[model samples]
Target: MQRYLEGELGEEQFRPLRLQNGLYIQRKAPMLRIAVPYGLLSSQQLRKLASLTRDYDKGYAHVSTRQNFQLNWPELERVPDLLGELAEVDMHCIQTSGNCIRNTTTDQFAGVSPDEVVDPRPYCELIRQWSTLHPEFAFLPRKFKIAVCGSQSDRAAIYSHDIGLALQHDRQGNLGVQVLVGGGLGRTPVIGSEIESWLDIKHLLSYLEAVLRVYNQLGRRDNKYKARIKILVRAMGVDKFREAVHREWSKLKDGDNTLTEKRIEDVRAHFRAMPYEQLDATAEAALLAQHDDPIFKNWLKRNTRGHKVAGYRAVTVALKHRDLAPGDITADQLDHLAELADRFSFSEARTTHHQNMVLADVRERDLHDLWTALQKANLATANAGYLTDMICCPGGDFCSLANAKSIPVSDAIRDRFDDLDYLYDLGPIELNISGCMNACGHHHIGHIGILGVDKKGKEFFQVSLGGRQAESPKIGKILGPSFGASEIPEVIAKILERYVELRQEDELFIDTIHRVGIEPFKERVYG
Candidate 1:
């Protein structure tokens, strides 16, 4: 960075180099992406992030879909100092972006999920250590992402990543991984294909290394348009891709990279059980208070989630303020969250891919108290998975790559459907908005997806339906042409009217879309 600043390095040479370290030159300023390893952060790390946001950024930072934090206004020269502070907290920005292995994400409920096959965090940690600054895999054709999920339900969106690992057990009760390859979003969204039904536990790292080696060698590098691993999979077909991976794996399997029991146990030791109480979780007062306190009941219904422990419940503190941008938290709020983590969640807090924070170990009895504190901090919006709890990007306001604005569109939708009763009846929906084809906002996976486009330098919004990003990931289909910005809310309303009328007794929005298809939605909106 100093060499570039001193004019010894050209912009083209310095651009990729700086991006590998998680720095991006945005439209107005430099944005620094700080990787929070697998979305896990201790109280000290959270406080350090808070301090950085307060000191370097504009009093707030955006939590990205990759389970990382972005400070948008750091001075170029002060970055070293900022990174120095981050290192003191055992944090850095290495391999966060560019053509390298990005952060390895996993189920935020990894060890705590009730139906988990095995804890995947130890595996995730092992991969993190191996992938960081890996000399062999660095400078790949394009950026890469990996996700791991141990639960029966995939909350990690494993099917939408470059490489996905699902923990599994055979009839003989041997632990292993279900390896997937070639999944990605962006311009050409594709679901991953299973390369190996069950890879042995010992060969996990070597198998992953084999996959990356294939991608690095065979994947396209000449054209930026067709550079991702997904394109390569599409070009060669899944059968050929799997064959290549197996051919490569045959040579590297059971080598030095193979896992050992002691090493795996040592990595697992970092994520031992928290101090949890043994009492039964009646949540007695909270359930009883529900009769009179509608607000608490509403929050309880949406924000809090089930815990594996008897007395605990994981709480999602929503960051989707109606007035502000979604997935945004202020420096002061980060500080408050650090305090809350210290008091309630064992000095640890987690960031989710859904752009929310999780106090994963909150006592069920203390939920009301936690809700009160969150409300005070303006982080207590009880709209998780609701229509108003939308996923959105910074859009044209901040991103140089955006074609149109997104935050305003999101706010317009939230304002149009502000009634909690109406949203509750609408059921859980993933509504994602992207400012461009980059799909950073993950519009392709939204049950109701919105995209912004530019035609003749005028902004327009396009809508799609039926996309999902769970265990069964599917890209959304477009609903005819784009609409003027003013017409989006009514188009959305019309679509919802059809959903309300056509949905079965206990069907979700995505389920209804799948059952009925996009033809009905097209007729309602166009007519």
Candidate 2:
């Protein structure tokens, strides 16, 4: 960094080095992406991040859909110092960028979810250790991403990753994984194909190595746009891709990369059970029933989820405030959230792929108090799983790659649909906006997807329908021609109106699209 700062390093030489360190030269300034390994962070780490934001950034940070945090306005020269500070808390930006393995993500509710089959964090950590600075995969054709889900619900959005692993148990009661390959979202959205129905957990690493080796060898290197593993898989066909992976696995399987029982147990030890209290379940119900405030009831129902433990709940700290960009939390909010985590959730919190934060182990009895604290901080939006709780990318405002600005579009939509009761009437909807085709916001999987496009150097927004991110994930279809930015909200309102007219009782927005097809929506929006 000193050499580059001193002008001793050329642009060609420093470009890859800075990217490897998670520094990106954006539209406005240099952005630093800090890896929050599998979205887990200690309260101390959160405080450290808050300090960095205050010192290096514009007093704020953005949470990404990949469950990472980004500092948007850091001085290029001071990024090294920021990273040094991160190191004190055992965090760094290694492999967060570049054509290498990025952070592996998983369910935010990994250990606490009532639906979990197993904790996926151990495997995520194992993969992190193996992939970090692994010489062989340092320069793949393009960036590679991995997601793991050990729960019945696919909260990790596994179907939209380079590699997706779903944990399952065999008939003989042995834990194993079902591997899916070629899944990705971008210019070409592809649902991952099941390459392996079941593989013993012991062979997890070895199998993953074989798959990477195959991609590293055969993935396109000539055309950057055609370089992702998904493109290669599509061109080769799933059968041939599976055969190629198997051939590679035959060579590397049962080798040193194979996981052992002791090795798995060792990593698992790092994520031991939290010290939970043995409070009665009925007591929790009674305590919750005491809250007469309808607003509190709405927040409790929308922003909190059931926990595996009897008297615990997973509280989602909504980052979707009208005053702030979606997924953005100020530095002060970071510090206060750290204190909240300490008091309520064992000094730990998890970032979700939905661009929200989760205090995974809050006692049911403390719900009202926690909500009050969060409300005061402007973090309790009561919009989780609603239209306003959308996943959006930092577009032309911050990203040079964007054709149009996304933040304004998101803000407009939020302002147009500010009524909580109206949002509840519409039910759960995934509205994702991307500045470009890169799909950083995972727009392709949103039930209502918006992509910013350039029309003769001017900005226009394109919409898609029927995309999903969870179980049975599907890519949304383009609704029609692009519309001006100012027209998006009215267009969306018309689409929702059609949904309301066509939907069956209790039907979701996506279900209505699927039932009657996108034609109805297109007609409504265009008419």
Candidate 1 C-alpha lDDT tens digits along 38-119:
9999989989998999888788999888889988899998998999999999999999889999999988777776877788
Off by over 4 Å in 1: 283-292
- Provide the TM-score for each candidate, comma-separated: 0.98, 0.99
- Per-model clash counts, in order, read 0, 0
lDDT of 1: 0.89
Q: For residues 315-341, what per-residue lDDT tens digits would candidate 2 score against the true structure?
A: 999999988899999999999999999
Candidate 2 collision pairs: none
> Alpha carbon lDDT of residue 273, candidate 1?
88
Model 2 lDDT at residue 486? 96
Please report the candidate that would top TM-score against the real structure. 2
What TM value does model 1 have?
Answer: 0.98
